[model samples]
Target: MTQEAHVTQGPLTTEAGAPVADNQNSETAGVGGPVLVQDQLLLEKLAHFNRERIPERVVHARGAGAYGTFTVTADVTPYTRAAFLSEAGKQTEVFLRFSTVAGNLGAADAVRDPRGFALKFYTEEGNYDLVGNNTPVFFIRDAIKFPDFIHTQKRDPYTGSTEPDNVWDFWSLSPESTHQVTWLFGDRGIPASYRHMDGFGSHTYQWNNAAGEVFWVKYHFKTDQGIKNLTAEEADVLAGQDPDSHQRDLREAIERGEFPSWTVGVQIMPAADAAAYRFNPFDLTKVWPHADYPVIEIGKLELNRNPRNIFAEVEQSIFSPAHFVPGIGPSPDKMLQGRLFAYGDAHRYRVGINADHLPVNRPHATEARTNSRDGFLYDGRHGGAKNYEPNSFGGPQQTGRPLWQPVDGLTGGTGNHPTPLHAEDNDFVQAGNLYRLMTEAEKERLIANLAGAISQVSRADIADRAIGNFANADADFGKRLEAAVRELRG
Candidate 1:
């Protein structure tokens, strides 16, 4: 058979390139009879459809993403030698995903939960992923408690609904969650939109200059739209009306040319200052007050383009804390260290082994060659190079860049210790400070919100314990929450 006779320029085809005939109808014994077994297209379509969906993320599953550009407005080369931040006014391609942390795939976007602010930067060195949340601090500092913390936020096994009792029980027992719980019950719990929320690389990271000088750093992506949030009433109403309020708001705003933006800033603390800091700098549950380490303006990030395909680009898109370029590295932050493994593992399980080879996740600004080859859906095109290194055949080799300096000493035996190294690292101080900073109206709202949730707990002991946590935050705070709960119950 000649090539021209067997192949046609255009037509719907099967996997083998055989033209699909009669796609509208299946091959049948007769018009009114049973279908024939020869209907390969029907079987193929059914099989593909059955396996269309992969597992949704265990957390931050409901999300919206957009393509954007990050333009460096200030020179940060003195602090970090990352090629993307090497020069002022340099623009890097970026993709940003905004999400609700505790929500299911079908959950309302306006729920009162921490929002995720993840970014993937396509730079010359490779792709750098900043997987962070909108809040400056998290509920738990250590990664070991992550699964337990998340379980509290999820549905009750018996009821299949989120239980306030479970949530309160966990937070009350885990005093380290006090700071973040305070933030959650505050007015800002429900952000007005993804555009108005500020993002933070909550964990401390390591940044080194071209001279091998290392500095501890944290990122703050302050929303240019300003911090706007929905009140409890507003969020509740929006949740009932439009489950996808946030997703729709972002997509429509970008389409209308009102692109949202953020001012990128970094709080750079000298490596030597970390040990002497008032609080543990690497603690995910705490934040560095602006009075101490002020944020330095570094860049502006603007989301100008909506994704063309939500599933292929946004749903399948992956981000990880381990994806670092030269000059930028991880710190001893416990949560971050665990994420360095967890995020990549989740991506492999949910998006396939070669998830990075996908168009949305692939490195665009530089060539990505790796010894990693041949997995499920291995779509990368690695030109005939040997998959293994140390070969006479010329292939891509390791970089000549200087390796990161290792830690000078190690202390403490490996077992789950309830307390951290810092003697003054009690969880209540910061949470109390936060409460004292709030205005009367904000405090009233916080009390009301906290009471409303705690009031629903069927367990009186759990509710009382939660009230104690509030009291520990502030005598006034605890009294108000206790009063509110009593009044509501009565």
Candidate 2:
């Protein structure tokens, strides 16, 4: 049989932009035998198909993103000299990615998980990324335990599935997880949609003003759509019915012109205040009481456009808390400190060294002038320009100004040391306060939710240890949890 030479240009092309001769059928060995390896089209298609996916993030594997604008509403010059936040009414382009912390790329959307709220501001100075979560606190304060905590949330080595024993055992052993664990088992754990929940820059960060005066800041993005959540039963149904429920809702809402928005606010504390604060201000597992430092409205973030390609735009996009403009810098927050290095390093490995050169990640209003030269996917944007500094040839020179003020008074010896505790740094205090603040119905729901998970553990000791942390937070909380777990397990 003679294969017809159906050669025609109809806009279908290969990766090299060459027009494809045939896409429907492969060039086979006389139409019956094994396919010919010399068929370049078949080889190309197979190779590309095999390499289509990059490694999914160890955490936050499932995500959705959109392009948006952040409009400054309040003058914050006294707080920081970051160009994007320098003047009221100033606007900056932003890309926000919402994600589930523990689920895989193919996992259902409506699960009880901490949603990643990573925002990238394409500023005039450079890109500023505020990487955070839906909750104000996290399970553990230190980054050293991060891998262990995530491991428990992931698949068990023996069973190849997430095990209740692993999760409860870790949470039980780590007392610092009480506050965040309480938050996680509450009603807000499973958000109805990304737009319906609040986002928090969970770690404390430093903001230095033009005067070189420093302040600690925490960001909050209150959803304009208002807080809405799904019960475990409702979430299970939704997950089964529509696996991409949250992602679909976000895209459809923007398409209909119902742009999702959040009122951005910041809790600012004087640099001096952090030293003698009631609790460790830099602790990732605690929240600054609103009474002590009120949240001042700063701006509004509205997502108006969805990404055209999930892989090229959303998945390839990278963020790091270290990606800051002048006046903004890291705090002593242990987790935040660790993330400053881990995030960028992960992007470099997963997305390649030239990930920043991607359209979604490149600076919007300013050119990224760096000594960084060619690597994988290098676009040759430099175009034979001088890649070195201190050259007689007017290349980009340093402004002799650091992004943030230097820390003073370092007298401690370097070793594995726990952070010095403040006046009220007990891990359970805030958790207890949170539990007490909840209404009776809310507490009931929280206890039920916690019990449902805790009861799944095979060992009674692990259940007791997990319940004990909550008990330390509040006697009533522990008692109720104990009762609920017993009933459920029976």
Estimate, for each residue in 221-319, the C-alpha lDDT of model 2 and write its tens digit.
999999999999999999999999999999999999999999999999999888889899999999999999999999999999999889988899999
Q: For model 2, name the residue pairs that clash.
A: none
lDDT, residue 482, candidate 1: 96
lDDT of each: 0.90, 0.93
Candidate 1 lands at a TM-score of: 0.95
Model 1 alpha-carbon drift over 4 Å, by segment: 1-10, 400-403, 417-419
**Each prediction's TM-score versus the true structure:** 0.95, 0.97
The positional error of residue 76 in candidate 1, measured at the CA in angstroms, is: 1.3
lDDT of 2 at 427: 80
* lDDT of model number 2: 0.93
Predicted structure 1: lDDT: 0.90
Tens-digit lDDT string for candidate 1 (1-490): 6645555457979977878877898888988789887788899888999998889999999999999999999988888889999888999999999999888888999988999999999999899999898889999988999999999999989999988889999998998899999998898899999999999988899998888888999999999999899999999899999999999999999999999999999999988888878888889989989999999999999999999788889889999999999889999898999999999999999999899999899999997888888889876588566888867788778777753445545687898765355756778999999999999999999999998999999899999998898798799999989999999988
